[model samples]
Target: MKKIIYTMILAAGVFSTTACVDELDQTPHTEITSGDVYTSAANYKSVLAKVYASYVIAGQEKGGGNKDIATTSGYDYMRCYFNMQECGTDEMASTWLEGDKVKDISYLTWDASDPWVSDTYYLIYQTIDYANEFLRNATDDNISKFSDSDRALIKQYRAEARFLRALSYYHAMDLYRNIPFVTEKDEVGSFTPPRYTSSQIFDYIESELKDIDGDLLDRSEAEYGRATKGAAWTLLAKMYLNAEIYTGKARYSDCITYCNKVIGDGYSLEGDYSKLFNADNQKRTNEIIFPLSVDATHTVSWGATTYIVCGEVDGNSSENPLTYGVKSAWSMFRLRGELTSLFASGDKRAMFYTKGQSQYLDTGIDTQTNGYLMTKYRNLLDNDSVASNTASYGASIDFPMFRLADVYLMYAESVVRGGDGGSIGTALGYINKLRERAYGSTDGDVKTTDLTKNFILDERARELYMEGTRRTDLIRYGKFTTSDYLWQWKGGVKDGKAVNSKYNYYPIPQTELTANPNLHNDNY
Candidate 1:
């Protein structure tokens, strides 16, 4: 497995800027051409690395210079996604009052003009376009001059590029239900891509995933942070799991099939749940199917797990500063009351600081002690060692985008959802496996009778908190916009209230719609 080093490719700067153009007729502001960049197989590998780098690194030059998207501060793919996914749900709350529409997200008052919304939308397309450009230039005929081994590598790279495009489109379909669909064949700056319905996008993603299934690296063979067969299976299972939400059709049986494929690929849960999130998570590749690899030294950025580590630290906690492995705490994010209640007192997964912080959020004020601070995603290793660098600006922790534990949960949920070809007994066993780890013993394990639809939802919250899956889980359970499940500061009220159902899917960013005439906003 090769370490994914963020090397500066020759025309990467031009590639980054050109893929972000919104206008159909505007020429890209670049001096280099595709021929100069894609002349050799090594160059193609470098560009492929750039396509992966687009998600973690915010700018062309490292550390706060020449940003990929300049409209928002701390604008990166995972950071923006975390703000939209975790902050708005019951899992997290923030007291950072810099007025970046984070409060809007926490309170469920976001609109099309929100900066994070625009940032996320632009970042998704930028990633998709980058993948598109790679697939376009890295074709077999174009790379015919390369050696046999390099050509084989380029073939895998092309498949990975397609997988990445499908992943971004999946995000678009999940977040913005209706979006302009583009691909490698779509000529840049020639015509505006038309919008596709959510169902159409769903079919496209399903087909793309299946088409590349044979071409991708085996689940056990891919390098760390690279997409593999398990990653595609996880994404496909997720799509099928939420098929009803996206396409108004139930595909639980299909979801179970893919989940089983990933489960059979030999991924096991990490013996210690806490170690699965720490700085050295990259070393624990047995469980993590795919990770957004972050390092404090090489892949330094303000986004990724840096947001999780710094933002969740408490200002006045009794723990040593080195316990967090970061220079200073941002003291921004905290867990809401509803999230803390899901864990039992003995459950080790309740990794929250409650000394000075209150469980209840009163008045919805932006104070340090308003809510319990979370320590789930620390910068320390499992052995309590600090990461290599302690800089406040960068964190060494890697964010696990998909792991085997979630696959187990998905299997259980699919069984509870009346999915065929899977047994309730196996689903119960999977749920208990997680419980045994969470409790450090089999004492907390539940039987088949306890495995209900509602129990699976609560168990997901307990097992997968602050992992950027809460909002989607809430929406699938029909509690995101209803009063049945409310957290502090929901609907901009301290007591928490129901919001409009239209918020289930975020509106397409207003900036995108204004720049491209083919796109339109969802009527929320």
Candidate 2:
């Protein structure tokens, strides 16, 4: 049995892969190999740390202040925006296909040769490699040395690695229906693993999560903000919820099963909706399952805290001078007016957006023209960075990867899909629970009989804006290829208009394409 406190290095010394990319240029920092560093437990910890490094990096790029892909400016390249009539850049050429109403965003059009898609693929796969290394080297013998309590920790770590890998694959499958499924660390070979169908990929993820569910500690043993049984079940529940879209077969029953597991596992909604997004509430509440943990001192996690640009009166902005007064041109995403108006008069989510007639920028808020500015991650009035402009710019919100609310919603959806429980009744019970928490009201006499998929989709949209699941959810519901946002399809326009769906999947990188002739490119 493996000793829990000890570390073991794989006996294979100095395994390295030859690069097919520009060999003369300095190698990427990610390509660096283990140079006798795997000899101790601390080294193993570092490796584990490295596995999570990508979350911070990607989080910085996507969810950070840049708001690069979340805003109207980001969608300027797509042709879907009827009101905002122009493509912004060639880089966003693929976004035009988001809702499929029309084709072409920018006057310029390009194929899969775009670098953005390929770059993300590389980043995600690199993360998977880090996780694979841990899986390959973390031996049961080395892990058994610890007391049972510590052994659970090791198992948790292993499960965490697998979860990350599965997450990376889920991302890949979302963007590109076909991708090489790499489960282990091996040299890129002549034996190319053909792309698995999207259905197959989801199956793979569900199976992996299920296999480790028993090994995972019960919910009480799980620490807050870490991957736990709740997190795994939530992810599996979501995968099952979307099974019909991915595989053309509904797995609502399975979805409900996982959702029930998460609900029965003892997670409840945090009392305040605002608590879920504020930095001060991090790890203090049990509402969240798996969160990307960022510490003020330890991790250097700026997140969107410095990036989202809004004035102090908007309720989401801080009064700080440094980051407070600064204006960011890229308020890239805004909520659809249709979605914002769907809330009940007393709905708590209404506060998430600035409503009609509120001046945005310099213009009066025009309901017919202006959209609702999402305040989910905005800086608060009394933020840590309130005095310091640079420090107090945006809200230090922990990105919720999985949460109890989501589990409840997924369970409800599963009931609608025919789980053993009262389909509409089960779903309504959870939705009402979420509503109570969202409005900060006591759970009393809540009721609903409808459980439409479209309604659930809208609820998810309201709850999860700019949190990175937008694209996947949109695609699964058949809305991605057709949404007419201001910035459409990778900023490319066709026939003097923006084009959409030109590049659904990221193209295989030029470097990879050249290296492995066996690998084929997605229609770039």
**Best-fitting candidate, measured by lDDT?**
1
RMSD score of candidate 2 (Å) = 8.2
How close to the true structure is residue 514 of candidate 2, measured as C-alpha lDDT? Answer: 67
Model 2 ranges off by over 4 Å: 1-35, 58-111, 141-153, 188-193, 301-332, 352-369, 378-395, 419-422, 440-448, 482-511, 521-524
Q: For candidate 1, lDDT tens digit of each residue in 1-524?
A: 12654564736333532232442112344677787788676777778887787778777554545776566565688888888888788888787855545877777888998777778888888888788888878777888988999898888889888988898899888888988888877776665678899999999999999998888999667767889989999999999999999999999999999999998988898998888888888877889998888886656787778877877876566645567887777777778888898888679998887887778788564766777888888888767878755464488888889999999999999999999989999998999999999999988899899999899999999988888898889999999989998777789887789999888888887766776787777565
Give per-model CA RMSD.
Answer: 2.3, 8.2
lDDT of 2 at 231: 76
lDDT of 2: 0.51
Q: What tens-digit string does per-residue lDDT give for candidate 2 at 312-395? A: 223332222233333332333344434455566666766544445232212211122244555555333334343123343333
* Candidate 2 residue-pair clash tally: 63
Model 2 — TM-score against the truth? 0.72
